[model samples]
Target: MLGGFGTLPGKLIWPTSVTTSPDGDLVVKDSGTGHIQIYSPDGDFKQRFPYGFEPIKGMGDVTCMRSGVILVTNGTRIIQLFSKDGELIHELKSPKLTWPYSYGITVMQSNKIAVSDWTDGGKINIIGVDWRMNAILKTNAIEGFHRPVRIAVSKNEDLLVTEGQLFGRFQGCCIKVIDKNRHLKRTIGPRYGKTFSFENPSGISVDSPGNIFVTDEDRNYIVMFNPDSSLSAVIVSEGLQGPSSLSVMEHGLLAVADCYNHCVKIFRYK
Candidate 1:
């Protein structure tokens, strides 16, 4: 309840994404005002990155890396690297990206960054630490992605991306799992809810214990999928405007962006 309707320091207006710094500060990217606001552990506004920093005009997502540097998406075109103290360090973009925009990004311990392109059949590009665009990950249309969005990397080296939004008589949403070898492991979709299946699972994260946490945007709840492929629990099922994005901290705290509600909700998911 730290942020809600209002124009103040800690108040948030229609935030689209939430992530945590290495030391546990909450980093939120608001599309409403196009500002990246960092809050202290106790919810005090610590730093702010103003709008217009991106030549493209808005910030998309914020991912705080282990080195304390923050990687921010331009909403389209490129991802910019910024220092924890709020200085723009560098930018990560590839001349080979045909789509030009990235809505999702994840930094690996191996110094590689995974960027997602939701357009044109769905592609995830891997970039080296030196900032060279490596490879557009090899994925079969059937085995891996149909329409990909947010992506997460697990401790066991599995890359999970939200895949769905297919048209036709066959309609459903699922999480596509890829291993270290870049081979498709399996696709896990919504199956256990009593009233509805997972509708518009936009954001996903894999916990240390191999459990998966996903945000069902249309349903306004967060679903926990166990490693055994079973539904564990559903969080904030009521009063959520649009639970679209989620981030799991190193210490296991879950940060969810309640899109339409104009706030971010933090949870202790065990």
Candidate 2:
């Protein structure tokens, strides 16, 4: 447990996302407060700052670029970049996006940024290193997205995006794997071993070996999938309430944004 309502420097309120800096520090984003917090590898609080103008809800995703710049989405058409110390760097917007409700975000090894736009059904837009639109993932009728939220990039640069309905019945609760050429490769969820079914697949992360980890906000646990897309294990189940986001940490550890619990949970996976 890293944060909660308290006198601590890094206290979190409704944290929705977590990522690691290149130097092995944890950077967390709280949607309830629109703030980001940094903590040392040993769970010591470092600093905190507001990532947006005001406390905004549904601002649910954050990622740290390899260059140490933090990129965050505020559920708007623009994405904000900030220094590790919480200083504003710049804002990224593509003219191609109209009324985009940005949600999930991830940066590839090639510096290509993948952001999920929730408007008009849902689609992932790939941004170039120069902050221009490179490609927007396209799907046919059979592969249309319902509501794509959190996303991850595999070792081969394939995107694994989680799609689910927000209101009403939860439909399209699965991870859609799309290749670099903007093609749907396959979907992973529902009836593999008949042991688990994803309700709301929110946060996603890929380990060094290309293993995928996902947080099921509704199911209240974390699940891991091998590179082969088979269920490797149900890694975390106890003491979780709406695990919204997760990131693979250094030295075989995992950090999860336990949303309902109002804290980040760390676990050793190896």
Q: For every model in order, what is the number of clashing pairs?
A: 2, 0
Q: Report per-prediction Cα RMSD to one decimal.
A: 3.8, 3.3
**Ten contiguous residues with the weakest lDDT in model 2:** 134-143
Pairs in clash, predicted candidate 1? 77-100, 77-101
List per-prediction Cα lDDT, in the order shown.
Answer: 0.71, 0.80
Model 1 lDDT tens row, 1-270: 557866576677777778878888888887777777888766677877854444443225678788788888765666677788878777655565444656677877676777776556667766655543423333222233555667888887678887546443224477778778788887777556465576677788777788889997777888888886577888658877777688776656788888788888778875
> How well does each candidate superpose onto the true structure, as a TM-score?
0.85, 0.91
Cα RMSD of predicted structure 1? 3.8
Model 2 has an lDDT value of: 0.80
Candidate 2: which pairs clash?
none
Q: Which sections of candidate 1 miss by over 4 Å?
A: 51-59, 131-144, 164-172, 192-196, 250-252
Index of the highest-TM-score prediction: 2
